[model samples]
Target chain A: MKTLTVDLGDRSYPIHIGSGLLGQSALWTPHIRGRQVMIVTNETVAPLYLAKVREALTAYQVDEVILPDGEQYKNLDTLNLIFDALLSRTHNRTTTLVALGGGVVGDMCGFAAACYQRGVDFIQVPTTLLSQVDSSVGGKTGVNHALGKNMIGAFYQPNVVLIDTDTLQTLPDRELSAGMAEVIKYGLIADAGFYQWVSDNISGLMRGEADLLATAIERSCACKADVVGQDETETGIRAILNFGHTFGHAIEAHQGYGVWLHGEAVGTGMLMAADYGYRTGKITRAELNGLRVMLEQAGLPIVAPADMGCEDFLSRMRIDKKVMDGRIRLVLLEKIGEAFVTTDIDTNALNQTLCAGAQLGY
Target chain B: MKTLTVDLGDRSYPIHIGSGLLGQSALWTPHIRGRQVMIVTNETVAPLYLAKVREALTAYQVDEVILPDGEQYKNLDTLNLIFDALLSRTHNRTTTLVALGGGVVGDMCGFAAACYQRGVDFIQVPTTLLSQVDSSVGGKTGVNHALGKNMIGAFYQPNVVLIDTDTLQTLPDRELSAGMAEVIKYGLIADAGFYQWVSDNISGLMRGEADLLATAIERSCACKADVVGQDETETGIRAILNFGHTFGHAIEAHQGYGVWLHGEAVGTGMLMAADYGYRTGKITRAELNGLRVMLEQAGLPIVAPADMGCEDFLSRMRIDKKVMDGRIRLVLLEKIGEAFVTTDIDTNALNQTLCAGAQLGY
Candidate 1:
């Protein structure tokens, strides 16, 4: 296993990435401060992998809260279920919570840990490539509300993150492609070479090649870790990490969560951002084409839904957390692998790009 | 106006404590980052004082979320109402939430702000003595759950805490007495001379003597501020602030929220802890007697309910957030002026103390 330290001083933790890292007592036991541990997962993942986690945690008294799967379940009601289980079992502040699934589970469990007795230590055992590379690393933990996705949450870092690529063997093809969207995001934001690498290794990655998969996870995590270390609260440099998210979150919010995978929405959103960047003369048409080509190769959508109007999209994007004051601030690319945040883009230019991207044939 | 700054560096903010301070634009407007501001209040305080607060913000766009009165309403359901109102009005992260009532409103609103888009600036406009003297100063914001009091919350500090004594004129006698419990607690745990002062001026304080109440609030806030400055996350010294809280929270949780005023339960719990302290040889019988006398004089309970058994109380306290590794940690008074946290108290001794205190006539 390869370990990367997140460098958050006392709140810092290790992100262990490799195959079969889950069930490694040396990685998890030291972080377990209390005798009781509660593992939070969802129905889909529980039936598939809960027993292995339970067996691995036999050294401590273990309790499980298996929730129904999907982003629709990531709400206050679901959060209360974990709270109810913890309170019923008399789990105190010292009891650690183990998040055992993808982004949905990680966000829900991380939020539950944050709300349980104010806050507690949580261990992230990311099961999907999407989570292993992105959501599992950042301390952004929250649940979505009916009005918006991730409307309620806290920036709480986990005590430890255990990434087991072995679980990816069970992830469906659609989910794997969705996860690759975020993997591609890291390259788009800061690493041109890595973006090119992903472009070259797209097929190898899709084939479940371990070495390439590991490299992608590590590079994405390292990129995220560096940005988080500089701006843990998403105040400055961290906003750049959300290069495609403003448009992507709007799509997810408009289409309804769980309809399109987060990575898929981000994938399409990144393409939209690239097209917008090209239209604004900040990026070359060739660079935008390269992004579209790679995403298409990964089997991800490169165009916005024809039914989603530019006005509605703009309105939805305006409410994004990244928007400050009345202006919608977006992280736009100046070139391939170089992103910058700005609210200065002309609305006419953005609208034209949105219209153009929407009409593009898939 | 007297301003005491809770120096949390970048998170540091001033506590403006004086008569009619809420009407002072200089104290509030600077903190208003954006034009949109939402004030959260309860039914009782709204008709009486909400207009004045709204008028004070005449230069900016203002909205109000008027919730029902009492601690029973401090929950996720009520919090969701605030979130709904903010979203319907399109309140972004720049939107400031001004908590304009007692602890219930302050906590619910602060927690709402903390969770709304991760977090937003929240200001405290405390209308009750209970809130002004205790809850308002500290950054401990949370909503209560049916299983436990403050079962879900975050340690989020306010941008400014505005205490206007003019609003206190409408407070009922019972509410004032309830607040006195926390004021007395600061003396019991950290300041012996303050305890003596309260003992001497208990009748005057109960009668709403302005100078005496001001002195008490200032001293109590200072003591709390000192502890919080050293331990913002309640790692050590701050736990002392929960001296009677473990037992008190259990009482609140068991009796059902709003059955007893929080300060009323804490008043009784403080007496129980003093008795426990004496039984464990950490405090003198004289100190315990002083605590009981002061509480009785303030018209607060000095004992637990006779209906509660030691086992029930023990079971409830064990689930407290302060519990670590299955052991119940408690804050006990060493003397009138000093307190310490310990888990060493014997169960039998605690049971004896509970029995003794309950037997004392209210």
Candidate 2:
């Protein structure tokens, strides 16, 4: 078992990573402040791990809401289901909501907690690799809007994030690879050694080797925690956390939310950013190739959709949350393991990068 | 103009009170960091005050979304319109939202700002006296659910609260009385002198005497600011701020929202709390009568809806946000100008208070 603390002063919480931690009451009970516990999960995860989580929360008045699975369900209409269940059960301000699925579930539940009665306590019990390595650590919780992804949300931190690695064993291979994009992102934005380590162990991590996967999760969260602790609300350096997210969000928005998994879009988005870096002479060809090879080895997408043109990417990117003063700010790589946000894009160069399409990162 | 600051460290903002603060660019422009400004107003307020607000923001890229007026529209479904307008306008994280109506507009816009791209800057331009005295000073921003009022929202503070008292001249007689319910409340919970002053000058204030209304607004905001600064999230002393809200929410939820204005319900609720205080020997009968007379003189309801019985009140109050565990915690008056929250209610006494019907606060 490995534990990493996201130090956020009063909002600080621990990320507990290990196998079979779901049924362990001692691991989560201390975080459950109120007797009324509502477990928010989805249809996919409910049948698998809901009972284990329910078992751990027996001492409290437990209620559960099982939402339809998928990124497409991550919107305000779907988010209201959790609120309905809470109101029907008379869950009060003291009630603590437990998010028990992947990123979609965690994001909705955390946001529900934030808005329910003007904010309540919520604990994250992430059941997927993408969530464990990414969503669970950051306090960014919200639902997606039809116009854009995560356009409606809050930065409400969780009481604790209990990551039971045993649940990842049930994740599909595609999902596993998608999670790797964020894991690799940690190395790209902040840690060169961690980046090299992720590249070296990419295949094993994809294969779900417990120790390697656990190590990757720990390192990724630690790197993210360090960044978030300094810039909790993304005023400055924290924007780098969305390194590939601008282009990734464009892909997600263009292709429809569920068409490409978030990590998959981000995986390809990182490659595009890397290609832009290479074209701008910020990184050597070998550095760009190194990132491309890692993403490919992890079985992630390396390019934007062939049909998505410069306008498609440009139009979607304009509405992204990262845009400021009508200028789209993107986190582009200066080098592998180093990224910076800039609105100083040359139109011709950006058009070339966008028009790169299938040839991106080749 | 009288300026009072709600000292919520870092999130602190000023409450500016006087005539014609709406067109003063110096007051609100300093608060708007971004060039894109979205003004959210209602149909009622737009025809009157929207043009003035727009004229003040001529320097920025201004957009406006006019929602249907009334508290009946204060729900999640209606809240979505703001999101739609924001996304369609390509408003980003830096965009500042100006709430230019009453409480409904302020609450929805503030919650929209809080959730839009995980928070943004917003200014409160409260037109109604109800909003100017209460909602603008407190950061309690949210929409209502069918099951309860204010069931979904956030404690998002504004950049500043500009109380243009001039707008109150156009306010209806009913709305003016409704606003007085909150003004009277400030005296009931924290200021005996203010309470007496409101009673002695109720008719003049209700008749739209500018000086008296301005003084009332200042005192109400100052009292609210003091309480909010002490307990922002209602962990302790701040619960007193909701002295009548628990019972008030029950009435509002039972009668259907907007059927009775929020302040009217709260006025009756305050009477009920005072009745409870009298029955419990916490205050004299004379004190209870004083509250009833003031509510009556102010043209506010002094009794709960006749159809609403003990069961209806209990059933709805049980789901209120103030409930902790299965116990319903209520803010009951200890005296004319002091209140306390308690979960220790004797069934018989509570039933007597609930069954008071038309005799309530008499």
Candidate 3:
């Protein structure tokens, strides 16, 4: 297993990437502090992998809360279930929470852990390729509010993130493709060479080549770790890590949550941002085409939905967490593998790009 | 106005105490970071004080979300209303939340502020005596879950707490008595002299004697500040502040939220602890009697409900946040002014004390 550290100092944690890390009990058992453990998973992941996790946790008293799998379940109501099970079982601050699914489970469990007894130790056992590469590495824990995504959460780090690449064998092709969006995002925002590596190894990753997958996950985690270590709160440089999320979140919010996978929305949002960047002369047409080609190759959408108007999209985008003081600040790529946030774009140009993207049938 | 600093170093905030401080815009305007502000109050408090607060914010753009009054309303449903208003109007991180009611409003608004855009600065304009002395001063923010009281929350402090004693005139006698329970508790757990002061000046306080009320509030805040500063996360010393809370929270949880006022349940819980302390030889009969007399004079309950069974009460109490590693740690009094948390107590002694108190018809 290759390990990458999210260097957040006291809040920093290690992300383990390998084919059989989940079977390596040594990686997680040391972090389990209490006898009682609550493993939070979702319906999609519970039946498939919860038993292996439970078997691994046999030395400790384990309780599992299986939630309906989707972004729709990521709210206060669902968060209550984890709390109910913990309190009903008399779990205390010492009780450790194990997040055993994709980003949804990780975010919910991480947030529940954050609020449970003020805070508790949580280990991430990500089941999806997307989560293993990205979400599981960052300590950004929270649920989405009706008005915005990730509006209610904290920057709470986990003790360890157990990323078993083997679990990706069970992920749907669409889900695998969805996660790649984030994998590509890491390279797009910070590592141009890594972006090219993803382009080079897309097919090998699609074939579930373990070595290639391990390299991608490690590089993505390293990029995230470097950014988070510098700006843990997303105040400045870390905000760049959200390259396409401003538009992505709006797409998810506009389409209604769960309709499209988060990474799918983000994938399309990244394309929209590239077009916006190109229109504003931040990137050349060649760079925009390269981004589109790479995203298309990864099987991600590159257009806004035809039914959604640009004005409505703008309205939804305005409420994104990154939009400070009511201004729509978007993370736009200056070129492939380079991005920056700006609110200075001309409105006519933005609308023109939105209009063009919508015509392509998002 | 008498201003006391919470002494949290960099995070320390001033607690302004006096009559009519809410009307002084100069005291609040300087704290407003930007042009937009959201004032959160209840129906009961809004009709009475919202206009005055809005006037204070006349220099800036202000929005108001008037929630329903009572502890029952301190839930996610009500908190979402604040988010709805903020999102609908595109309120940003710079938007400050002003809690304009009692504990319920302060907690709900504070929790809302904590979750809004990850967190925002919130100012407490505590109208009720309970909040002025307790809830508003500390940063404990959360909403009640159906299964438990304060079962969900975060320790997010406010930027400032403005206590206006002038608003107390409109408070009902029952609410005033409820608030006094907390006032008296400060003396019971930490300040022997303050306890004696409350015993001596109960009548004056009940009769709206401003000087006595001011002294009591300041003393309570000082004690809370000291405890919180020493242990902000409730690891050790802070547990003493919950002297009556383990049983009190259970009573509140058992009877259903809003069925009994928080202070009323705490009042009864205090009596049970005093009895337990005396029986266990931690406190003397005279000290126990002193607590009873003060509670009686303050018109607070000094015993548990006759309808509650010892077993049921024990079950509820065991689920309290104080329970660590499956053991229930209780804060018991050693004297009128001193309290200590113990997990070494005999279970049978606690049952006998609880059963004895139930049979007393208090």
Candidate 4:
């Protein structure tokens, strides 16, 4: 078992990673501040882990709200379902909300907690690799609006994130590959050694080796926690954590949410950022190809949607949260292990990258 | 102009009060950190003051979203209009949202700013006296849900609260009186001297005497600012700020929102709290009568809805944000000038107060 604490001062919480931690009441008992608990999960996840969570919280009054699964349902209207459940059940300020699914459930439940009666205690029980390594650690929680992905949300932290690795054993291979996109992101953004480690053990991770997968989750969470602790609200250096998100959000919004898994879009988006980096002389072509190789090996997409044009990417990217005034600010890689945010993108290079088809990493 | 700062550490901002300050760009220019501003107003207010505000913001790229006026529209559906407008216009994180109407506009816009791209800069230009004295000064922002009022919202503060007393001149008689309910409340909960003053000059304030009204607005904001500064999230002393809100929210929710203006409902709620206080021997009958006289003179409701049974009040009050562990917590007057929150309630006394009807003060 490995535990990483996201040190957000008073708002800080721990990310507990291990096997069979879900049914262990001791692991999450202290974090449940109130006598009442509401477990927010999705249809797909409910049938799998809901009962385990309910049985664990047998001491307290428990309620459950099951939402439809998928990123497309991550919007205000769907988010309201959680609100309806809370209000109808008369959940008070002291009542704690437990998010019991992947990123979509975690985001919506965390946000619901943030707004329910002007804020309440929230806990995250992430059941997906993408969620455990990424969404669960950072306090960024929200729903996606039609105009853009994650356009409506809040930076609300959870009391604790319970990551039961046993759940991943049930995750589909495609989903595991999707989760690896973010694991690979941790390396490409800040850690060269971790990147090299992932490169060396990519196949082991893909094969569902418990030890290797656990280590990757720990390292990813630690990196995310470190970044979030420094810039809880993403004012300065924290923006670096969004290395491929700008480009990825463009892909997600243009392709329609749920079409490409968030990790898949980010996977392709990172390649796009690296491509531009290589063209701008920020990173060597060899480093760019290395990232592309890792993404492809992880069973992730290495190319943007064929239907999307330069204008689609450009227009969608402009609506990104990183955009200031009318200028688009993007997170670009200086090399395989370092990334930086810049507003100085050359249109010609960007256009070529957008126009690049299968020739991207060549 | 009188300036009072809501000292919330780095999140602190000022409340500016005076007549004709809306045209003075100098007051709000420093607070706007962005190049773009979106003024959110309602149909009732736009035709009257939108042009003046737009003319003042000529130097900046400004956009306006006009919503239907009234408290019934203060729900998640109307809030989506602001989100839709912001996204369609491609408003970025740096964009400042200016709430240009009353409490409804300020609450929705402030909440919109809080959730738009996980928070943005917000400024309040409160036009109604109800907004100027109460909503604008508090960082409380949210929309109503079907089951409850303010069931979905955030404690997001604005950069500045621009209160133009001049706008009150155009306010209807009932609306001006509704605003007085909150003004009277500040006096009832925190300032005996202010209560006495309101008693002495109630008619003049109702008649729209500029100096008296301005002083009343400043004093009310100062009281609210002090309470907010002490407890930003209402964990402790701040809940006292919702003196009549628990009872008030029940009225708003049961009667259908916008039926009784928020302050009017609060007016009756305060009297109910006082009635309970009197029945519990917490205050003298004379003090309760004094509060009733002031509310009556101010043209505010002195009784709860006759159609509402004690069960209705109890059921609705349990859903209040103040409730904890199925126990209803309420803010009650220890005396005319002091208020405290307690979950300790005698069912017999509470039922008596709820069933008092027009005989409340007696």
Estimate the TM-score of every prediction. Answer: 0.97, 0.98, 0.97, 0.99
Backbone clashes in model 4, listed as residue pairs: none
Model 2: per-residue Cα lDDT over B2-63, one tens digit each: 99989889888888999888998888778989889999999998999888988888999999
Instruction: Give the least accurate 10-residue stretch of model 1 chain B, judged by summed lDDT.
Output: B353-362
DockQ score for candidate 1:
0.76
Query: What is each candidate's fraction of native interface contacts (fnat)?
Result: 0.82, 0.93, 0.49, 0.94
- Stretches of candidate 1 exceeding 4 Å from the true structure: B281-287
lDDT of 3 by residue, A1-362 (tens): 77778787677777777777776678878898878899999888888888888777788889989898899989988988998898787787788999999999999899888777667889989998888877887788889888888888776789998888889888898998899999999888788899889989998887778788888888888888888889887778888988878778888988889998999988988888878777778777787787788888888887777777888788887777777766888887777778887878789878876778643312
| Candidate 4: stretches off by over 4 Å | none
Q: What is the TM-score of chain A alone in each candidate?
A: 0.98, 0.98, 0.97, 0.98
Of the true interface contacts, the fraction found in model 1 is 0.82
Q: Write the per-residue lDDT of candidate 1 for residues B1-362, one digit (tens) a residue.
A: 77888888799888888998877778889898987899999899899988888878998879999999999999998999998888878788888999999999999999998999899888999989999989997789898877888889999999999988877788899999999999999988999899899999999999999888888888888888888898898888899999889889888888889998999999888887877878778777676777788888899977687688888788898878888888889898777789999888788878886667456422
Mark the regions of model 2 whose C-alpha exceeds 4 Å error after superposition: none
| Global lDDT scores for all candidate models | 0.87, 0.90, 0.84, 0.90
The prediction achieving the highest DockQ against the true structure is 2
Proportion of the native interface contacts kept in model 4: 0.94
Write candidate 4's Cα lDDT for A1-362 as tens digits. Answer: 78889998888888889999999999878998889899999999999999999888899989999999999999999999999999888888888999999999999999999999888889999999999999887889999888988888999999999999999999999899889999998999999999999999999999999999999999999999999989999999999888888888988888789989999988988899889999999888888888889898999988778888889988888888888878999998888889988898888999999889677776
Using Cα atoms, each model's DockQ against the true complex is: 0.76, 0.89, 0.59, 0.88
What TM-score does chain B get in every candidate?
A: 0.98, 0.98, 0.97, 0.98
Candidate 2: residue A327 Cα off by (Å): 1.3
